[model samples]
Target chain A: MIGAVPARDATLAERLRAGRSPRRRAVDRAGRGLALAATLACVVPLAAVLFFVVAKGAGALNLDLLTKPAKALGTGGGALQSWLGTVQMVGLATLIAVPVGIAAGIYVSEFAGHRAARAIRFASDVMVGVPSILVGIFVYVLLVLPFRQFNAFAGSVALAVIIVPVIQRTTEEVLGLVPRELREGSLALGVPSWRTTLSVVLPTARAGVLTGVMLGVARAAGETAPLLFTALGSRLVNIGGFGEPMDSLTLFIYNGARSPIAALNDQAWGAALLLLLLVLGINVSVRLRSMGGVRA
Target chain B: MREDPVEMSVAAPVAAPPEPQREALPTAPSTVPGGAPLSLAPPAAGIPGAAPATVPAAKIEIRDLNLYYGPFRAVRDVSMGIAANQITAIIGPSGCGKSTFLRSINRMHELTRHASMDGQVLLDGVDVYSPEVDAVDLRRFVGMVFQRPNPFPTMSIYDNVVAGLRLGGGARKADLDEVVERCLRAAGLWDEVKDKLRAGGTSLSGGQQQRLCIARALAVDPEVILMDEPASALDPVATLRIEELMLELRGRFTIVIVTHNMQQASRVSDFTAFFSMGEDRAGYLVEMDRTARIFTNPREKLTEDYVSGRFG
Candidate 1:
């Protein structure tokens, strides 16, 4: 620490001088300052958005928003139907996508031989970049036209299509991260390749895979473009089935924000806050799981 | 498949008639006469391969083996007979394909993409390369412990021990407890781990985890256990413990180990095989002999130099 050389600061100054020059110290301080500024730049906008939504919406956001319906629009109406529809469609989408995405991921990372896997990988990367509105249009043509209706099932199909590629990519990357040593150990015990994957490989990558699923859910929950042509929106509190048109927070927010009524706009802001909370909750829980969850 | 003396003699056991064909088969076995070798091969410190004139009963017969990682031949034309219930150590410098030779015995080498092998590895004198012999089944009888201790992080100690039996097929629900205890006991881990059987395998100390892996290998009751520098990642005491455990396991399973530690080879192995990379970068067997003879009086100059630490 160069304790013998310093007089004014009892060796602190000498230690600092020995470790880093003045220019290097200044550079380090500047680098730290830049990093903090960058972090704040990201966080400030998010905080502002969250605060704005809550401030405008908190009055309308009550228990009635969950339990009651938006029966009297342009009045103090709740969005019970919209919330339920959002839950149903997102649930269906998750159900449809999770298994298929994880399976595709396993195929790409584990048994994928040569060019076919590469092509599938390439396709998934491209899929992630396709415009969300374009995906909505694609689903509209495929499902809405085929069924001759804008139904909850069609909405779910759109969300699932968007979610599948994201989850699959994450599963592939995390599964690939599992060290080859474990595979060999399992195989050396005479475990078949499929069983090894199921029992050992999949479990090891479980947290990361779950993170992917949650990320997909968050992304799909916030999407308004895909739902515009699928679920459309309805005033009914409880739609009969997947065949019926559904009401979602995003769709309601989209329709209400442009309305002239102040009450309707307040309800839209309330729905946005609820949707934001749901997405943020999923993301936060996923990060928590990733930090200290059961890892193989 | 060709009716060579070794193949013809070995084939009799697999295809023997139910009645009396087995009686005549054991009389003139190629590796041993009357099949006493597997049971009666006494454990003496490095005595099994002591005499160059007397060859032990070969449990595994690897002939003209070549291993390739794509176009790059990692190991070339290597042939060695591993004795039944005896420890054989393959010692060499880094990238010498000693570990490759070890992995190819159970076909673990084939797991890598584009990895290919040309040759025959006979287990109980049956060609493992034959299409009829499933690699999965071959691995059941010929197990391997890696250089790094890889206890399944997802599993408890009890589960990790019985992982082989569970996933490797032939595990009965009723026998799981017994099998886990037996394998752990055999691996010299029962006394330390019996109380916390439900604890995660990864929570154990490094040596304990390695032992847990060994226990996992033993869960399926393999006849041959291949170790690739099993103690390299361990501390000195752990290394000594593992070496001692190998000595104790000698008469139960045929052991083939790859080690960079020459003292360990001298201390633990019955037979020592030296591998060196040629100018082509393909590893070849330089010499195979009794540990005592190879360490003291060697045939190959390369073996002597390596043993003396004159050069890698």
Candidate 2:
């Protein structure tokens, strides 16, 4: 009689310890699978684009493509002229934009209540959303057409127009990130307000500002739409200012890719590859600089 | 268990010994016809019902003071005087305008664009809020330390201590070095930080940073020092050090401190003002008296309740 009762109790315990409901188990498995699928979906496109660019462009990248000038007439040569033009124009644009952009950003972030600052911020936001081609047209009318010619200056102005809003917006956002206690501490020292901003607040946000400026440069460097109307195009290497037409890699690619000759097409690919590498190198440097700032 | 009779006599008074009846009170030096007495003594009883004028003739006096932030009134119709070379602690719970009262003394609240005040703040018998008196100069006379120790994070300890002196501008190298040494010593931090003068102020421990801030305030040689919860962020040992420093500071500079710690008020202050909330949550000073009497035998029920930890 005792053995029969113990056996019955054991059977009841086994029934109570049964596995999870089938529907709940299926739902948990499906949730895990769905999360995995979502993550893969987001990553796949980025990996594919990186793979395609490296695979298609790596063979054409060499020192010659970087050091020599573009092809003559319909023949293959190099991208030195286009490369130089890109550098000069972007360099000039940066020189013009960084100071004005950063100042405007500081004004907006530091004096948010002022009417003029509000207007400037609004205009910057509007400008950022405007198409690059519109900026090119605006510059063509306001600058290039007035001179009756396209030149490196016109190209730079167009690029500056595009870059200014980006730098201003990013700088304002970064400056806003600096804690108010830092500013207040300096002010409490009887330090004049402007000096406090320059000496204490700006140094704290320097890395973020630099990263923003570099990102602006990267964005403006590859802009084919703006340069199409501003710099026009040229096969020969020229170093003149606003008076003469200039060469750029984007224009070189656009013009060369249309050529019937196979050699010209190959040179165009090399120029494209060079542009990519330059931007990539800059991005890597910016990342390293940001990491260094974090550690510091 | 043997207390001296002299100590008992000195400790017995709930209020200052009634100013030797008017006839015996010393008159001011007659250098200037209408100049007030240099001594910080309570006013004689010429006017009736003036609440016995507990506060002495002012190192600092705020008269009919009203503070506003846009539409909201923070402190209203408040008047008080801080005595020379005494420690006055303003104790109340959070948002009772204790910190506000402290900041108003140095005009530190004026840095806020929306903050405005209507009243007279007299420092050394001169109206600090007068149009001719610069806020910067006012701050030099009445330096302040905040609730949190903020020692200019980017600056070295030496620079942090000397910042106000440098801002005062144009002192010779010997004078500056002397002042830095004197102020750091007064702040009780010179011995610990003497070797690390070049290290960043932020590299110091929390208590050290607070002491550094005190040193920074001392560097300016202000006649009055305002501290708002200066020791609240520190550990007990650090807090004791700061309290001891306050006592040391009291011999030289008049100090006004705002604290939530009732025990701190009793331990470090010569006078304590008990502030409490009213119908609209507006804070008003319930009583100001000798610290010993305020703790042991407060006159006001609210003051008694707060000190006894019955309610805040």
Candidate 3:
């Protein structure tokens, strides 16, 4: 029976008995090569930016730039005061934003079955889509105008407004990613719904939630527009309360970049590099934590 | 001329009269032993307060049960008595309410938002549908195995088996370990999985996953077990294993299974109930009888036609 068929007349199965044909095989190889080329094309620009930042900024980085006060407009300077102001303002913003944002996200994901929940979710989405500059203007009106001056507290409020949407959206998405089956299983076991959410669902989605928080920090850390109208860029950092004007890394970069002196320009690059490194570190740590969760 | 001479000495025995034979036929019309006329009548007259003479007092009784999804009635007036420690298999084709009926027994149907039922499901002489009876407690006494094996993917095999027991309340470590081992052994999965009890339940093969589900169900120590197409998703070998396990479990728990496999019903069940869709496409119980008689000599022509593979 096998011998009755001609070699070329073999069954379709026999034709496919080996692997791919030479022409098709070559095509597959070419397809893979094209994919690799496209990937390299996308990565090259990022690599160039990093290289440029390191080359220019590395020359200006020093302990003095980190530890001393900023110089006046005509002289060589430092970022110590700017760094302290950035820390205080951002810290306060984070403290205000994280809890409220996360709570709102949880409510939307877990309990928002009614019209109020729908309204909150819709409002949050709209807020997130709104321009950051608009948020700064709103905060400028609400806090800076009423107070009759730009202060650290006004800056923090602007930053908080921006941070809220980022944190809220991320938290909601992460909580939504937790499987419904897990929640159902917990509830079926006689655990109260809220307890199940807190102990089971939240714990399972913790890695994603942490990643969201990190992203929120990274976003709020580099915001310049909101800080401009609120903090108003003081040359020397003042570590006082809501009434005192403050300086941050972003404002320092903005101001130094606009200065006529070569020293100020150099200082801007150094501060930019510092901000980049902090954001990068946060991102990498979040990635590592997420991977650790998956492995476990 | 020879026949005439031979007939002269012949004498024949007289046959009985037709009237006597007719009278005897009425008396022998299959007496249901304990012989209650009321029990023999159709359920349309409604079962009286007197105990059902057709079967022993039901371990589980469903009455005037109607299930709906939105406005569509999926099942209507499904009343049946499930006897204790017996394997009762509900067999029907697709879309026939066998699975729905099984789910309603433990109120698992309540999980669907659009689903609703008007009924009374009694367990051990108490109405499970009563407002005072907790659904969670009902589920504890009447456990279910779904068509597909859904052992929680995140939980380990050991945890999957102990989930129900732990959910019941506090269990000592020694007692838990013993119960887990016993349930696994009862499911015929202990030897294969004992060494890897800590492995995720999802890592098991399809057959092993089904067995793990059975083990999970057994861990709760349910008095009645409801299985909805438990072996339908399994291969022939796995199906056989589940059939064997059902037979073994029948010694302890009342097992009510819904299956499309007639051969499986005949092989495992002592009693079989046949269901079919009515004119409205709503499912109803057509007939129920001893497994052997249902297949060989069904009283309902519809059942005989279905069992004989002439129609479904």
Candidate 4:
């Protein structure tokens, strides 16, 4: 019987080792080629945008472009005022939104019942897809009209509305990635539910969740439509507190892009380059940090 | 812990019914309102609540336990005594609910949605499921080690050992240091890990990580330790080490282990309880006795068949 088994197995092995037919080989090659094409389809556009911005914007770059405020009528000055407004407003927006978004995310992932979680998740998904112009209009009606002035605080609130959904959704997804085993292990140690969620679950998911927060900040920094009806853009540096009008990089690019003056147009390209680099820098660093760190 | 994946159920022939014990256990299903009719399998022979006078005082006594997940009964009419400061091994075929029965002792099964139980699990004669008894406090006394080695991924080795005490309240740094060393030594891991207390808990190898989890369990100073197939995921060498540790810990804590490995059960346990699934697919205990008696001369034919490697 053993000899018969070897004889049968030899035939099976011979059949399995038979080379792929010409048609199958051709199909496999075509599939590989198609996948490569799809990948290049994504990369080519991104590479072109980066190349064009650097090529056009690098010539316009100078210390004066970043450090000095824009000229009164001409384009002989920089976007110090614009960039500062962006920093303050986005920072303020982060302060307002991070706590609320993270708290809701934790509640949905760790405590809510199935129906409640689903409802909140659905609401956030819808909010993520809502138009930024609509958010600007809503803030216009809610804060700008009521206060009778366009203020940096109103702009921060508008950006915050856009940011909350991104942070909430990403926080929920990242927390979900933490293994159920970790929670069980903590609970089995006789730790109460709240302590388990706070000390163990949150720390385990910290890096991934922070990456989400950074992405949200990047998204908020580049928004112009929401600030159009809120901050309303200022030409001269308005050092007046958050209650006054503000100018941001996005607002600077928007106004500069529309100017008839050639210098102003060139400065628009420089501002665009700076905005792109900032967003790209944040995304790259976060990706690298999450990829290289040992999760344990 | 949401409904463990069902193991393939082997069709076990129906054995003759056991003689019913006195004191018909009242069924008080915790989750199901208007207590569901208890259609459980016939109760088995080991009722330590009414055992012969010579049995040692039971550290944990289970009385007519039936566990359910949603509507399906998983463990049926399990009543046995785990002797004080001794090791009791629960051995069974896959899908016979050995793990479920073990979890019920510490109320760990209640973590699963729709999980409920009927009857009593007494810890030192106090009904652990009583309303006034906090489940979290109960867990502090009855610690568990899981099948997989799950050390907190973000904590340092030292932090993982002191997690329970630190969470409960303040512990002096000196006390924490002392507990860490004592528990790690008890778990046979101090020599391997003493120099790297600040290293991430998950930096250790799989066997060492399992020992870390054991040391974490030991640090809480639990009166009873429940190990649910704690060494099954490990290699032969690691498995032997865990067995040796259990033997070393035998008299200090009442240890209850659920294992699929019958050799492991015989090697480390003082008493052995054999479980088998009835025709309805709810697991019930067949017999419980001294390990030597269960292996050499069993009261039930099923236990003999299982221990002799004739069948599971």
In model 4, what lDDT does residue A293 have? 36
Tens digits of per-residue lDDT, candidate 4, A1-296, equal 22223334467776556556666777899999999999999999999988988998888777887899987876588988888888889889999989888888999998889999999999999999998999999999999999899999999999999999888888898899988888878888788989998899888988878877887899999999999999998877866468899999999989988989888888888988988877778778877877653456
Candidate 1's residue-wise lDDT over B24-136, tens digit each? 22422234422333321223212222333233666777778999999999999886677766789999989999998899999988887899999878776688989999999
Clash totals in order: 0, 0, 0, 0
Ordered by DockQ, highest first, the candidates read: 1, 4, 2, 3
Candidate 2 CAPRI classification by DockQ: incorrect
Task: Choose 3 or 4, whichever is better by TM-score.
Answer: 4
DockQ of each: 0.65, 0.19, 0.09, 0.50
In candidate 4 the C-alpha lDDT for residue B213 amounts to: 94
Q: Residue A154 CA error for candidate 3 (Å)?
A: 6.2
Local accuracy of candidate 3 as per-residue lDDT tens digits, B45-162: 2322223435433567777889888788888787777656668899887898888888888887776658899978878657888899887767766877877776765568898788
What are the per-model C-alpha RMSD values against the true structure? 7.2, 8.6, 15.2, 10.3
Top candidate by DockQ: 1
Question: Which CAPRI quality tier does the interface of model 4 achieve?
Answer: medium
- Residue-level lDDT tens digits of model 2 in B3-82: 22122121222323322221112431122123332433334321112245554444676676777777777776666666
Off by over 4 Å in 1: A1-29, A72-74, A280-296, B1-53
Off by over 4 Å in 2: A1-38, A114-120, A240-242, A257-261, A283-296, B1-51, B163-185, B191-198
Off by over 4 Å in 3: A1-51, A61-111, A114-121, A137-192, A195-214, A229-248, A293-296, B1-53, B164-179, B307-312
Return the lDDT, model 3, position A169: 77
- What ordering of candidates by TM-score runs from best to worst? 1, 4, 2, 3
Local accuracy of candidate 1 as per-residue lDDT tens digits, A1-296: 43334466556756566655567777889999999999999999999998999998887788988687877544665888898888889989999999999999999999887888899999999998888888889988998988899888989999999999999999999999999999999999999999999999999888889989998998889888999898887878755488878898898898889988987888888899889887887678777867663344
**Each model's TM-score?**
0.88, 0.82, 0.73, 0.87
Evaluated at residue A132, the lDDT of candidate 1 is: 82
